[model samples]
Target: MKKTGEKTWQLRLYVAGQTAKSITALANLKKICETHLAGQYEIEVIDLVQNPKLAAGDQILAIPTLVRRLPSPIKKIIGDLSNETRVLVGLDLRQG
Candidate 1:
């Protein structure tokens, strides 16, 4: 996660395909970023179905996994990301 005038977020959303969970995760991520990071974030959706080779680089063993590759430390979250609160917490953001 990032705050105003802070580092840009290099996020990678790893998904298998156009599955419902994948779509939901992407949508949820977009909403979260818009509400929080806004212009300070960049999401790179990687469809494993198209390029499975990329999975190894991120050690992605699960579908719908989000990887925050920017800032000081990198963080990863796996799932549909429907829980807005949990997602925020995982990204190290404030509850408010």
Candidate 2:
């Protein structure tokens, strides 16, 4: 259903608010997407505070969770997103 040239790869970052961990996750996700996916990625940030119901939708068990919702296979990463290698692997941006 995604249009051509629009990223089939979809991502969502779940955070509580403007906390340090949340900020770091956002920044790190941006950097990775820019570096690897470039213009072929769509990132949607969801604030659990605003939409607490969505938490159950993704079955989120913790804060600062990154969900890759598209590109055929889904993936997830937890924590502050400070670990680049782990994120890359989780998002399938890099090989193990």
Candidate 3:
């Protein structure tokens, strides 16, 4: 139930500090948001190394898990986000 022109998408990227995989995920997400979502998205990066407890909240069993918290039909994408098509589809950013 988001307002018009007001996106309520809440995204959280769980990573283990600034590793190569984490850096890639961050860069890929930033690029996607800028190119597609633009000003209609909120991305929060969580460092698991700093807070392991948060992992349980999301039921995360893998490193670099991206969780779409807000908005209905929550989704998740694991790994370094190397597959653009998969990431976009998982996040509902692109039509099938």
Candidate 4:
């Protein structure tokens, strides 16, 4: 159970495997969360290669997808996530 008004970001990263792009996305996501959300966020990595059924839950159509499942109104960003500015905007951490 979550406390009301207490922000805890629930993030899900959908990846095929430990590919370079998937690894990069995870690294970038961690860096951003550490810089912004810090302890206020939880990340769940889902390897579609191992569990392909999980992708349907999030409707994942691409590799290295970042899904923001908490804080209402789910959002997704697909890529290696190397572009910091774009990632920040995509995650709604900053206004575009």
What shift in Å separates residue 55 of candidate 3 from its native position after superposition? 0.5
Q: Please write out the lDDT profile of model 2 over residues 1-96, one tens digit for every residue.
A: 677867877999999978999998899989988988877889999999998999999889888999999875778899998988999988887897
Candidate lDDT values, in order: 0.89, 0.89, 0.88, 0.91
Q: Which stretches of candidate 1 lie over 4 Å from their true place?
A: 1-7
lDDT assessment of candidate 4: 0.91
Q: After superposition, how far is residue 54 of candidate 4 from its true place, in Å?
A: 0.9
From the highest lDDT down, the ranking of the candidates is 4, 1, 2, 3
Global lDDT of model 1:
0.89
- Worst window of 10 by summed lDDT in candidate 3: 1-10
For candidate 1, the C-alpha RMSD (Å) to the true structure equals 3.6
Off by over 4 Å in 2: none
The estimated TM-scores of all candidates read 0.88, 0.92, 0.89, 0.91
RMSD of each: 3.6, 1.6, 2.1, 2.3
Task: Give candidate 4's error at residue 90 in angstroms.
Answer: 1.1
lDDT by residue (tens digit), candidate 1, 1-96? 456665488889999989999999999999999999977888999999999999999899989999989864888889999999988887888553
